[model samples]
Target chain A: MLNAIFSGDTPRSRPLTAILLVILVCLALGPFLFDGTRAFSTLGMICVFIVVVASYDLMLGYTHIVSFAHTMFFGIGAYGMAIATDAMGNNFTAILVGLAGAIALSVVLSLLLGLLSLRVKAIFFALVTLAVAFAFLSLATQLYNITGGEDGLRVRVPRELGPAFRPFDGELRGFSIVTFLSGLFTEPGNLGEVLRESVFKVRFSGRELMYYVAFVVSLLVFLFLLRMVNSPFGRVLQAIRENEFRAQALGYRTVFYRTAAVIVSAVLATLAGVMFALINRYVNPENTLDFQLMVFILLMCVIGGMGTLYGSVVGVALFLLAQNYLQDLLRLFAAQVPEGGVMAELVAPDRWLLWFGVLFVLSVYFFPTGIVGQLRIWSQRRKPAA
Target chain B: MSALEKTLDNKSARRERPWKALGKGPRARFAAFREEKPHLFLLALMMLVPLFMINPTTWAVLTISGLAMGAMVFLMASGMTLTFGLMNVLNLAHGAFISLGAFAGATVLTVWLNGYSGDSSLLVNLVAILPALGFALAVAGLVGLLFERLVIKPVYGDHLKQILVTVGGSIILLELIQVIWGPNEIPVPRPDALRGAFIVSDAIPLIGGIALEKYRLIAVLLGLAVYGLMTWVIDRTRVGVLIRAGVEDREMVEVHGYRIRLLFLGVFVAGSALAGLGGAMWAMYREIITAHMGDELMISVIVVIILGGLGSIKGCFYGAILVGLINLYVGFLEPRLAAVATVGLMVGVLMWRPQGLIPVIKV
Candidate 1:
């Protein structure tokens, strides 16, 4: 059914096929090829962030409505899951119940916002969403009894998923024998021990498990969104984005479509939020719902290139990577400077925000299309020149 | 002789009449007042209701602060509205100009206090005020001019690009301030003369009590003075007429040989300088200046502009006061709930009146 839906237009099929092949290769090699728990953890983090960026892109890029409250949905999902699994003490029903609650809450909130926001265009919409996000943050903070306020909520991993397994352990040995996966590894060595440790660590830890779950869920969401974007509904949304009045004139209910897009995007964001909760084994109002998070999400979408799923994924990867590395890079630069030098101040990790601000400004000024868009342009230029 | 000149003269005459025609009889005034009475009554109610509900100290402080801030919004937003109405450029860096002005004011104050052992006299402090205001305005004007020429001119009507550039500019300005001033919050002391509260009631009968802060009362008075002056300039003066015409039809004005770009620059500078003045005053009110103050204050100003109806000066004043009251009321009710209340009010107002309370006549 998936193949049938996507099996038209050679131009589109080629890229889609290549992408699928790459994904398959990555999934197949993810466990076997990687060594050290850090490698797997990094990949897991990237995958989860990709989910977040994808949902953000769906609303802002494709729909042309900048919902600044995107992070609030993530917060709701995270808090919902945390409250369910930990406070409610219903592990079996937790994920399901939490997700359902999150979706319902988000849908209702978005509906209210949609009615308020759908009439306005551009900056007004941005401001309204910003206000809504701030409101959510305030509520989350004020309702400290439930949300845990600034401190946040933490959950313990279920014993079944806890990190007790070794490769040679009876339970895993039996599973390996049954699956004929024994040949995948030789006698236990450092590499084997490392792999074993990683697997055990991941299984025992709720966060690691959450990461994997989030990755799978995000993959499914990305696929679902891909389908939506290619569908007639998606086309109508794009039309609404390009020209709302014309779409309305053509008898397409633009508001309804836009609202539906917002709700769908909200659900995707909630999924990411849920996974985020699981990964951290905690949920905090401040971390999840704030101006900083909103700005970062906007920066990700804007810097990545809006209206493109791949752009969002790439954008998040670039942003997180830059963020993670920029501090180290700045420290390295700072170290070379003489002791008590002014340059040292510039290189401090605290000063990273300033640099990020500078980069944001420069990027917006010159590369409004973002890193992915720029790369695409460069590749096109290279092809033509060749 | 020119169409622009003729229009300007007509606008000037109309603006001058509001004050001059104040002597009209109660019956004739009552009839005219009936026409514009609702908005005026709403404004009065907005100002009065908070006083009745909250502690007198809080009410006095909030009212004075709101009016002061409203005046700043009026000044900053008037330019922004005109720029948007005329050129359709959303200058996100407008907040940065406010910050720049604030820093300028702080620098001036710092310089003035350089070698003084004891507290300065009221006369000395009063004398220093002129230079501080001048320094702030000059720096802000220069920054506005440079911003327009360097950054804003290229992306005149392209909103997305404009947004990107201006947002980027704001970030840069924020960082620049951080770099220059360091991360620590700086103290912005009120001049000696402006200190303490004026006892309005030693022991009044009906009303519980009210003792207004001398500084805040002064700030409000200053705000009113500026507001009145701006209204006169915008509505009655020759320059005001050109601005109105320019706002209404920039292309036609340009075609008629008026230097629209120069007019834009003038308005931008004036707007920015006013924002600077507001920032300086805000520093005194908050009693501390930090790197993030501009962004914090900008949020309230943005809410005001959105609520008031963008591109309308009258709307900005009305919107600012409404927002100011909402802010104070919410703060009074629950301090943490202020953010929620402000946003909720804005969202509700936007929903009820999509174009804002007083919709701008789009160019």
Candidate 2:
């Protein structure tokens, strides 16, 4: 069935198939090779980010709307779930309710925004959305009673069917259960016991479990988006992007289509938010609604190549990896510096923002197509000669 | 073609009677009456309305501060609108230029006026005003030139690239500021001359016996002076004519043997310098300057521009005043909701007229 899906005579198909195969193989072996509870947790985080970035690209790249408020939707979903699960004290039901509420709110917001500024072109649209996001952030922070102000709201974990999984300790039984359900198996007895104890002892916190759950949800959402992107509706969206007026002239309801795209993207963002809330077991107004977070998501979409699904995934992987590990790597390098030296000043924590700014400028200027786009271009160029 | 010709004819007519009439239609006439010559009739009524109200200070502060702020915004927004209209550039980093001025002024006080403690000595005053204005204008102008040549020039007519480059430029400027000046907030002290409020009355029985701050009254006067000066420069000067022509058609102006590039450079420098001046004055008024002030103030400035309609000076003044009133009104309702109030105003205005309160004529 998958081969048939790629049966088109286009030259791009074979390379993409090969790439997919490699990814599948890696995914299959990832849990075992990486081992340890921390590694798995990291994988989950990457997956969640991938979903968020992918959705961001769907609106930005496909619709050609450089929305600065995408993170607001994510916040809505997260806060929704947080409010429901923690304040309302409903778990399973809350998840569904939160998802629905987020989607509904996103649709309304998108519709209103579309009605207001859909006629405005390009940068003005971006500015309007930026204003909206700022306004939303201020509103969120101002409503301290509800959003817990800057400190944010803390959430309690939902009860699991069995005793809650422990990490880096003798939570071997629980770890085994999770691994088994996730389609992985381990040797029984002392080795399993040792692994389980290590995992539980290492703090198999609520964050790690949320990571797994987030990964599963993200995978499902990604596949659904992938399928949608291949559909006729997605083609219309692409058409709108290429030439909006031309699309409108063709008797298409351009605003409706664009608004629909925004809403769909918002729903996906909200899903990521919910998962983020689940993982962190906390949701704050600042965490989800800040301009910095919005800019970061935008950076991912821009760096990944705004319109492509694969690009978003690649962008997410690169961004999350750099963000999480780069500091540590820099720290290690800093440690080698002679004490009280200029080198120490260069690697100081405050100076990290300088590096990020430089990287942002470089990436926007030089790597506009990002990693996946560049790779695809390279492959295409190489193919003609081949 | 007729519409174009009609617009041209209307432009000529406007030039003949530049200050003759406020606007056409009864609604507009009423609005102009309310705004331009309200004659303290409403001020008296406002005084009476606030009578017997607890915390009358809040009302007095909100009213006077809102008016002062409105005037300040009018000046800043006028420059911003003209630049945007003529240049077609959003100028995302405009706020940075403003902060540069504020920092320059504050630094001058710290370094030069550290020990001087006199009331309106001409020398001390010159020390404060000259260094602040000169440094602000020079640095801001140079930065403006650099920005236009190196950054904005390439991105002309390309909105996305402009946004990206400008936003990146903003971040770079922000970091540079942080590097030069530490992250702590710096205070800008008011000169002894402008320190105290005017005593309207020792005892008044209006608005339930409210007393307004004197500094705010002085700020209002200064704001009016600045506004008058800007209006005079824009409307009565030869440079103003060239600017008006350039805004209408840069190509036409170039074809007429004028150097459009020099005009643009001059305009950019002037805009930046004006922003700096506003920032400097605002710093003294607010008494604090921080790295993040640019970002905070930029939101409202952008809102003012959007509401007034980009590129229209008259629009900017009206929009600023309207937003200022809304902000004060909302601040009175709930201080925390002040930001939201501005946004709500923007959203409402956008819904009613997405082109803004004053639509710029597109060439």
Candidate 3:
């Protein structure tokens, strides 16, 4: 698929490549640019959402299948890791086992649901998947012995990947490798003490390591999906979406193709879930399998533009930026308002959802094609005029 | 001569078996019954569950509880069925109205606690309750009107846009509710006259001991009354015929000089009002109210409609009852399956009848 598209090495896509490069640079330097792990953590979250939402696009945008069970696959990934960490011990090998288990489980579940629901009307399929997802959520919460119930399970990250630690108890306590390295060349110390502390201090905090890992894996997943979407097989899925009967008449086995698409999408979602668990170091039903998360994914896809995979990137970035920063903006406005005044209510953080709701409605009303879609149309129109 | 002879023979054969005109044997009879009362078979099947459970008294108690719970669900779900059926509008924000109704009822009850306090007679308590119910219905209905005009009117035909817009509307409404109601779960105080249970040692000889909550009994009655009113409005009136006609063919009805748009708006408002009523009842049943209560309840309502068959009133009613029974029964039998039981029932029903348990004929 990559060979079919990017292999052409067309100069027209240079701008997109540049954009990707800039984003990569910004993400790699997130720790320094953002001043702390908080911003890095947010960026990591955005990365996770990007992967998951893009995977959602595979079904919704490409295959034209609307499903509510994406979160079920996501939850499968998180719970798989949670269970594996407890039983197999929190090692790199355990993570690998968890990933493989999650992938297999997601594929099977997606296949089963796709086959059963694809037999119905498209609308009915959505409803049925919703029912199935709710059932899965209930099962996860109810089976406390296996799933750890509603409180969720805290994953024991490998020591090197855990919180930053230090050797010396005084000023050096909680010092990390990043800080140590920065001061290493500036300060002089006893050779023996320096050597001893260097070995101990040369460890990445859990969050920092998880951020780098999530960023790279998300990029790989995105690129892989991009390849899949460009392949002939992907074209067949698109064909099924455009005209299932025509595809079937052409001997395309539409059901098999559709089911395969669902499996691929579900697998990607599960992979995203694994990254989420690694970064958060915990797994719970609400965070992973909740219906609200599914709604959020849907919202992101719609806002980003349904068919364009890159829109997932734009959508997640814009959404997270707004959700995270808008509160700060409101707080600034609130400071200008008198205490217990009418304007204060308007600028309250609790009312942020109200403003967001309005923004969402207005955006859908005005930009039905979404940001990427509108840009695509604008460019196409400009070409003819030029 | 041969054709005439054959015709005469066919006529003579038909005359010999006149029962064939009505239908053939038990299969035909059963088919007719199934068509007329599609949910009866399902109801009968569900009833057999208790026989397997083997504790008749427990079954009796559970059945009552199920009925009470089902009634609450029906009140909320019926409104959604009407709106979706008549308008083809998927109002995901319908839950917002339910929560609003609950809040409205709570406000009225709180403000009039004196009327509801102490050992007042049921009649006097009804005086206090009636006003709360009325306020909820009116306020919710008006809000529905506003919602229809501002949010729903612009995007009538597009299902995708409808979903997005309605979700946005729901979020806005939920947040507004928090702003007004103080972002916490408020306790709903039951009236003094409706607090205790009606205990019977020998109400039925087979069931030695039976206890039924007074409030639940009232809820069942109230739900039945609402159901009766809705059925009557839909089945027995000229407006009902017109609404049915509009659903069948809007253009044809418009050609006949009927304003279908007005009818649609009216139905939407009424549906919202019904949701509000249901919300009040549910708040009372739970004895607590939260802004997001309506949103959470929506999953069950959607499941009920799906199980009952979309656009089907009787199906919604029957489906609600089935869900209520399944939740209770499964919770008792296997606690793990309780949460998923309603969905499982939906899947099972769809497997047998893919269209739903009772597919409504739109025309």
lDDT of 2 by residue, B1-363 (tens): 699999999999867554446568776666555544332323343345544452565666677778777776665566667777887777777878777777877777666665442346656665666676577667767777887887678677756666666766766666666666666899777766556655456365544445566556765776678777766877899887878887777789899999977877788878877777777767777989987677667778888888777776766776776667667766777878888878887887676566776666462
Per-model RMSD to reference: 7.3, 6.6, 6.8
lDDT of each: 0.70, 0.70, 0.80
Off by over 4 Å in 2: A3-44, A119-122, A161-163, A166-207, A329-347, B1-60, B74-79, B116-126, B187-193, B202-222
Cα lDDT over the full model 2: 0.70
Model 3 misplacement above 4 A: A1-22, A164-207, A236-253, A341-343, A381-383, B1-36, B112-119, B201-203, B361-363
Q: In terms of DockQ, which candidate is stronger, 2 or 3?
A: 3
Given the true complex, what DockQ would model 3 score?
0.47
Error of 2 at A191 (Å): 20
lDDT of 3 by residue, B1-363 (tens): 699999999999878555456776797677656555668877877878666874887887787788888888898888888787777887889889999999998888876654563346888787778888888888889999999999999999876678778888998888888877778899988878888888868746966667888888888898788888888888899888777777666678889998888988998999898889889888888989999899777877888888787677788889988888887787778879976878878777766677777766332
Residue A255's lDDT within candidate 1 is: 85
Looking at model 1, residue B279 earns an lDDT score of 77
Alpha-carbon error at A323 in model 2, in Å? 2.4
TM-score of each: 0.82, 0.82, 0.87
On residues B1-363, what C-alpha lDDT tens digit does candidate 1 reach at each position? 999999999889767445435567885576455434433654676777777778666676677666665665555555666577556777777777778778788877766653221255766776666577778888888888887887888887777667767776777677777766677888877776677767657476533366567776776777777778877998999888888787677798899898988888888878878878877777767778887677666666777777767666777777777666677676777787887777776776676567776666551
Clash count for candidate 1 is: 4
Task: Give the Å error, residue B228, model 2.
Answer: 3.1
lDDT per residue (tens digit) for residues A235-280 in model 1: 8988987888999999998889988888888878887887777666
The ten-residue window of minimal lDDT in model 3 chain B covers B111-120
